[model samples]
Target: MTTPPLSLRARRAIVMTAAVLCPLVAGAQTIAKPAIGPERPFTAPARVERTLSNGLRVVAVRYPTVPKVSVVVTMQSGLAVDPVEKAGLAQFVADAVQEGTASRDSRVIRREIFAMGASLTAFAGQDTSSFTMRGLADTLPAMMSLVADVVRNPTFPQQEVDLLKANTAQALQAQLASPQFVANRVYRQTLFGPHPYGRVGAAPETVANIDRASIVEYHKTYYRPNNAFVVVTGDVTPDAAFAAAEKAFGTWARGTVPPPPTAALPALTGRKLVFVQRPNSVQSSISVGNFTIRRSDPRWAVMNVANQIYGGAFDSRLVRNIREDKGYTYSPQSTFQAMGQAGLYRAVADVRNDVTGATLKEIYGEIDRFREGGPAEAELVNAKTYARGLFVIQNATQNGLSATLNTIYSFGLPNDYPETFQKNVSSLSAEAVKTAAQMLLGSQDSVIVVVGDYTKVKDQLVGFTNITFVDISGKPITPPQ
Candidate 1:
C-alpha cells in the first residue's frame, strides 16, 4: 500500500531537513576533475591535383560525409592589384562578374543556379579574390561551368556598372555614419600608409570613378588561368572533379599577369595616434594595431599561440582584464591576421566615453604583462588545445575545407598544410610564445585610432602628444581649441 500523504506542516519540515543535509553530504564527497584524453590523430582526406593545358590548377578533395559539394575558383590578383587611382576596382570587378556573363544575364544565371539547388557568390580580399559555388553532389559539373562562365566571361554591362556605382556610393555614405568604420579606416591608413592593405574600401568619390571600361580592363589584366586555381570539396570522386574542372576551364586562354605591387609599408617609429571627431557621441571606438609577419612565416605558429594567450581567445588576458574585471566594454576582441605579404595584430573595443582611457590602459598592461613573462605552462597548454581544436573544427566541413585549400594555394603554402597545421600549433613552447610576443606585441610603436566626440575624450587623451585630428572622412582638421 502507498504511504498516506503527510500533513502540510510535516511535509515542510521534511523538505527543510533534506535540503540542510544535502549540502553536508555533497561537501563530504570529493570529486576529481576528469582527465583530458589524448587528441585523436587526424588524417587529412586524400587530395588529387590536376592542371589544365591552359595552365589552370585544380585541387579536388573527397569528403563523402554529405550529399553536397563546394567549389572556389580563386585569382591571385585582388585589392593589391587595384590601380592606386582606382581603390576598389578589383572588388568592383569581382562583384560585377556575377552580374552578367557573355552567354547569360544575371537573371538567367540566378534562375539556373536556383534550379540546381546551388549558390554562387564572389568576393575580393587583400591578396586574392574568389568566385565560389555550392550545390548538390550531382550538380558539381554544372556548378563548375557556371562559375567558370561568370569569372571568364563577365560582360561588365554599362547599365549594371552604373547601378553598382550608385549603390556603392550610397552604401559608403551609410558606412561612414558608423564610428567603428571610421576608426578602422583611419587606423589602417595610419598603419599601412600608401600600401594597398590600408585601403579597405572605396570612398563615395572613388566608387563614382569606377566605370565599365576600367572594370573590363581590370578583369582582362588579372583574371587569367595561369594566375588562378580551383578548389573542389565534397561527395565527388577526384577523377570526376578534375575532369569537370578541366572540361570547363581548358579552353580559357591564359594571360600575362602583371607583377604584384611592391609598395613599402610605412615605418612606425613612435606611437602614432589619430582621433576622428564625431560630435555629440556618447561612446568611442578604439583600434590598436601593429604590423607583424606574413602568412607563410615559420614563426606564424608561435605568433598565433602568443596572440591567443594574450588576447585572441575570448577568455584571454585582455578580455579578462577589460571585460570581466574592469567592466569597461562588451565583446572586446583581438585578432591576428597573416596576409600574403604582411600580417597585422589588432585589438579593438568600444567603450563608454568616460572609461575609454581606462580600457586602453588595461589593454596595454595585459600586452606588456604577456610579453614580459609569457603564458604559464597551463595557459600555454590550454591555448594549444584550443588552437588545435579550432583548426579541426574549421576544416571539418566541405565549405571550410574548400576555403582552407583556397588559402593554402593563395598564400603559396605546401599541399600538406592541413596535415601539418595541428602538429605545428601543438608543438609551440612557452618560451617561443614569449619570444613572439616580445617581437610583435607593441605598446609604444603602435597605431591608435579613437573615434568619438573629441571634446569628451580629449582630456583623457592628453598623454598622447603625436595625435592627429581628422573628420569622419579621414580628412585632417584642426582640433577644436
Candidate 2:
C-alpha cells in the first residue's frame, strides 16, 4: 500500500488542534487542591479532680459525644524504681497483674470484659505503669470494680509467672535477631552508662530470676492509693465519676512509695563508636545520640520544634537528604524522650551495608547544620504548625483525652500543660530554636551504635576515635581468635 504525505494546510490544522488539547490536559493535571481551613481554637475540656479519703486521686473529664467511657489507673512505679538485681520485676508484675485476681482468673476476667464489649490493657514504661479500660458508659461501675481488683489484689500465681517468664525470654531471643533492636539496646547503654535509663529492656537471665514473692513485694511497695491516680473520660459527670472511683478504690489502703532511685551517670567524654557484629547482615542499623535536658526543662518546646525540622517527620532534613535525595534507606527518624531525669535525643536508620559509613556521615552533617544555624523562619513556622496540628489530633477523642491526662500526671506536669504546650509551640521563633539546638545537640558527646557485618564495615567508620565491640546485651566482646 502507498500513502501520500499530508498537505501543508492539513498539517497546520492538526498542529493547532494538538496544541489546544495539550494545554487542556496540563490544566487537568495541575488542578488546584483545596486549601486547608484555619485551625479552630482548641479548648480542652475542664477536668475535675478529687482526692478520696484513702488518698487516691481521681481526675475526670466529660465528653458526652457518645455513650462511652475511658478509664486509666496509673501508678508512679516503673522501671526507674526496679531493684538493681530485679531488673524486670516491674514489667513482670504489670503483665501478671491481670492474669488472675483474688476473685477472677484470666479466662473469667477476659470473658466478663468482652461480654460487655469492652477492652482492657496494662503496660509499663520507664516512669509509670498503667491499666486502662474502655466500654459503654453504663458499664463504668463494673469496669472500675474490675480495675481496682486487678490493681489491688493480683495473686501473681506461680504458674502464670513461669509462663510469662518463658514467653518474655522467647521474645527477647527473637528480638536479638534484629539489628535495629541490637543497635537501640547498645545505644541506650552507651549514652546513659549505668543509670536505670540505660537498662531499656530486661535481660533473659533477669527475667528467669523474677519470682512470685518479689513480684508481690514490688507491687506492695509501689501500687498504693497514695502513689497512684485515675483518669476517667467520657459520658459521666465529674461527681458521678468521683463517686464511682471512691466506691471502687476508697478502701484501698495507702502505703508508702519509695522515692526515686538515683545513680551517678558515667561521663561521656567524646565521640565513641560501638559495634555489634551481625553475621552476613545485608543492612546496618545505626543510632547516634546523647543525653539532653529533663522533661521540665524550659527549652523543651524549642527542642520539640527543632527535632521536627531535623528528622522527626517524612520531610525532615535527615529523611530528605538520606532517603529521598541519596536513596540510602526508606525511613529514618529522630526522636526525643524527655523523662524525669536527663532525656535522650536519638536519630536512627537502617541502611545498606555498603552505604553504612556514608549514612553516618550524612546524619552527622545534618545534625551539625541544625546546631550551627537552626531552622530558617519559614521552616520554623512549618514545624510549629505541624506540632500544633498534632496537639489537636492527640485529644480528638475520649480515649485520646484520657491518655493525655495520664501523660500529664505521669510526667508530674501541671494540669494545664496541654494549654501551655499550645501557647509555647505557637509562639516559638527561629532564634529560640537555634538557641535550643546549640545547648542540646552537642555532637561531640554522641555515642554512635552500628549493628552490621563488622568485618565489612569496621574500617569504613574511620572518623570515630574510640570504637568498641559489644554483644547484643551491650557487654563488651572479644575479637575472634
Candidate 3:
C-alpha cells in the first residue's frame, strides 16, 4: 500500500548535490578536492585566426586528439531574415546545399562523406546559417572544398526543391501531431506574436506555399563570404587548418550587406494561455514563461545565477516543487537562452493529461514564489559553485571549447568571458539575484501553452482561458461548418 523508497540513483544524486553545494570543512570555506577530478591539469590550446581578402573571418584550432575535423562555415543571417511568405526557406536551403553542389550531385556528396567516414551538414537557423563537416583530418581538404562548393554553387535543382517541399510537408504533418512539438509551436505563437520567431516551422497548408524561386532569392541574399565566417577546430594545427580552409574558401566572392532582420519583434507582457485539443492522449506537454535579456547584457552573471537556482538545473525549484512535491510530472526545467541579438526565458514540463491543470497551477505558484523570495542561501551557493565549476569541462572538451570561443567572439564579448564567468557568478549577492529574478521571471506577462487530450482535460483547461481550439496543422478547425 505504501510507495516504495527512492531509487539509488535519486538518493545518490541528492547526496552528491549536497556535497557539491557545501564542500567546506567549517571555518575556511575552502573547496574539497574535486570528486571526479580530471586526470591531468587543464590548459587552453592555442588558436589562430585570419581575415580573408573578401572579408570572411577564419578561426582554427588544432586538436590532435582524434583525426576527425570539424569545419563550420557561418553567416550572420538567421531566421530573423525569413521573408514572411517563406517562413522555413533558410532551413530548406541549408538542406538543399548538401543535396547538390557545383561539382557533384547530392548523392555524390553524400557518398563522399560516408565513404570517407565523415558527415556533411548544413543548418539554417534563426540568426545564423552554417555548413559543417566532420571527417578524418587527411580528408579535410576534400571536405572543405566540398563545403565551399556547396556554399558557392548550390544549384537548387528544381526537382530537389520540390522534393524538400514534399518531405518537409510530411515531416511537419508528423511533428504537428506530437505533444511536445505542439507545445513549442503554440508557445512561440503566444510568446512572440507576429515575430518571425513565433511562426510555426511549417503548417500543413504553409509548406505547399514554399517554392524554388523563393528558395533561390533567400540563398543569394544570404550566402556570401562577406557575410560569413569559417571556423575549424579539432585534430589539426591552426596552420594546417588555415591552409586547408584557404585552399577551399579563399576565393569565394564577397556579397552585399544583408538588409536588416525582416522586422524586429515586439515585447511580450501580461498573462496568456493557449490550449490545443487532441481527442485522445494520455499526457500533456506544457511550456511557460517569456523573453529575458540578451546574452551580452551586463546583467548576465546575476541572471545566470538566478536562473540556475530557479529552474536551470535538476535541483532547481521548478524540479523540486513541480515533481518532487506535487508528483504531477517526471521533471521540469527552465532555460535562459541569450544569444547575440536577444534572448528568451521559458520553463517546460509534461504531466498526465488528467493532472494538466494542477501541474500548471503548481508551476506558476513556484515561479511567483521564487521571484518574490529569491533562492535560498544553500540554493544560491550550490548554483554558484556549479556554474563556476562547469567552466573546466567547458574549456576541456575540444568541441565545447570551440563552440564557446565562437559564441564569445561572435557576440563581441571580451576574450575573458570563460574566465570571467566563475568569478562573476560567485560574486553575485542575494539581492542582486532578486532584482534579476524580478526582471527575468514571470510577470503577468507569463504565457502558458498546453497540448494534451481534449476530451480528458478541456474542462480543466477552461478554468484558465477564453479557450481557443486549434488542430495539428496549426489551423483553426471549425466544427462541421
Candidate 4:
C-alpha cells in the first residue's frame, strides 16, 4: 500500500528543510581549486652549431634528460620542390631511402637498429624531408652512420620500388574511403588551386609514373650536403657530437641545387564551397579556413595567441559555442600551419548530418564574433598560459626537442626562436591578439569543404552558395537529384 500525499504545510516544511541542508551539503563538497602560480622563467637548452667542411650544418644540444639521444637529418627539399608532373616524388624518395644501402640491406639494417634499441624513420613534408633515429646514447655514432647510409646510398632497388608502388596504390585506395582525407584533399585544392601545396600525396597515377631512375635522379638533385642539416639532442658534448657527425657524413659532396619552385597562389575571394559526395555517409566532415602568413613572420606570436583563444584550445570560443553550448558536435578545433613559403588557418569539425548547416553557421558566427569583440582579459591570460605551457611540454623530451630544432632550421626561423618564445607570447597585449584576430579570422575570404552524402546534406547547405560538386578523386561531377 502507498502512503497518502502530505498536506501543504508538511510539504512546505520538508522543502524548506531540504533547501537549507542543500546549501550546507554543497558547501561541504565545494573544494576550491589550487590557484595557478606565476609562470617560472624557461631557458631553452644551449645549442652548439658547426658547419662541416662539406657544408653540412650540425646542431648539437645537451638535453641529457636520459641515457638516450635523438638524431635527425633533414633535407630542405620536400614536396615544395617536386616537379610539376611528378607530385609526391620527394615523399616517394623518402620512403625508398631506407629499403637498402650500398653495403646493408633492409633486413640487416633493421637487425642492427633493433639490437641497439633504436628506431629509424623517414618522412617528407611540404618543405623538408627527414630521417630520424632515437636510440641509446652509446649508439649515437652508429645511428648517425646508419642514417647517413640510408640517405646517401639507397640504390632504389627495382623490386622494392615495385612493391612500394603496389602498397601505395592500395593505401591510397584505403585513404580515399576516409571522408576526412577526402575533405582535406579537396580543401587544399580549392584554397591553393594549382599550387604545389594543393597536392596531398602520391596519387595512384603518380605512383605508377615513379621508377628507379626517376628516384635516383631526384635524390641526386636534392640530397646534397649543402642542402641539408643535422640536429642531435641527448646526453652528449658538442665536440663529441660534431666529431660523430663528421665521421658519419663528412665525405658527402656538396652539389649545386636549383631554387625551390615558387608558384604564385591563386587569388581567393568570397566564400567558396566545395563538396565531395560520399554517398551514405552518416556524418559531415567540414574544413574551412584561409591562407595566412609565412613561418618566419613576426606576427606569429600574436596569431598563435588569437588562434588559441578562438578555437585552437579545448576551452576556446568555437568549442564552447558549438560543442559545449549548442551540442551540435564534438571535438571541433582550429589550427594554424606555417611553412617556409606560406601559412594556413583552418577550423575543422565532424558533425552529424542533421546539424551540418547549423554547425557551419555556429563556426562562422563564433569566428565573426571573436574577431569583432576580441577575447576577454581572462581569456587572454588563460590562452597565454596554455601556449607557454605547451611549448615547454613539447620541448621537454629528446624527440620533441630534436623536432623543434628541425622546424627551426628547416623553416629558416631564427636560431633563438625557442629561447624567446615564452617571452614573446607572454608580452602580447589583448589589443594585439584582437588585431591579429581581425586580420586573420574573417569568413569572407575562406574556403569551405564538406565530405558527406549530397543527398543527405544538400538541404542543410541551402544557405551556402558557390557550391561545386566533385567525386572522391576530386574530379568534377554532377550531383544526384
- For residues 237-296, write the lDDT of model 1, one tens digit per residue: 999998899888989999989888877888897888888889999999989979999998
lDDT comparing candidate 3 with the true structure: 0.77
Cα TM-score of candidate 2: 0.93
Candidate 3 per-residue lDDT, tens place, 334-383, comes to: 88887655677888888987788888777778778878898788988888
- In model 3, how many backbone clashes occur? 10
Question: Higher lDDT: candidate 1 or 2?
Answer: 1
What is the model-wide C-alpha lDDT for candidate 4?
0.89
lDDT of each: 0.88, 0.86, 0.77, 0.89
RMSD (CA, angstroms), candidate 2 = 5.6
Please identify model 1 stretches exceeding 4 Å from their true place.
Answer: 1-38
For residues 1-481, write the lDDT of model 4, one tens digit per residue.
9999999999999999999999999998887888988776667899999999999999999999999999999999998787766778898999998898989998888999999999988889988899999999988889889999999898888888899889989999999998888888788888888888887678767887878888999999999999999999999888889989999999999999998888888898999999888889999999989998888899988998999998899999989998999887888999898888888888999999999999999889988888888889999989999999998889889999898899889888887899899989989998899899987785788899999888997898888779999989998999656
Q: TM-score for each prediction? A: 0.93, 0.93, 0.86, 0.93
The CA lDDT at 404 in model 3 is 77
Worst 10 residues of 4 by lDDT: 199-208
lDDT by residue (1-481, candidate 2, tens digit) is: 8999999999999999999999999999999988999976568988989999988899999988789999999998788888767787778888899999999999999999999899999888878889999999999999999989999999988899889989999999999998887888888878887799877757876886778889999999999999999999999998889989999999999987778888776788898888887778898999998888888677888897888898887789999999999999999999988987779889999999889999999998998998888898888878988888888888888988788889888887776787777788888878889888776666877788888878877667777768888777667887422
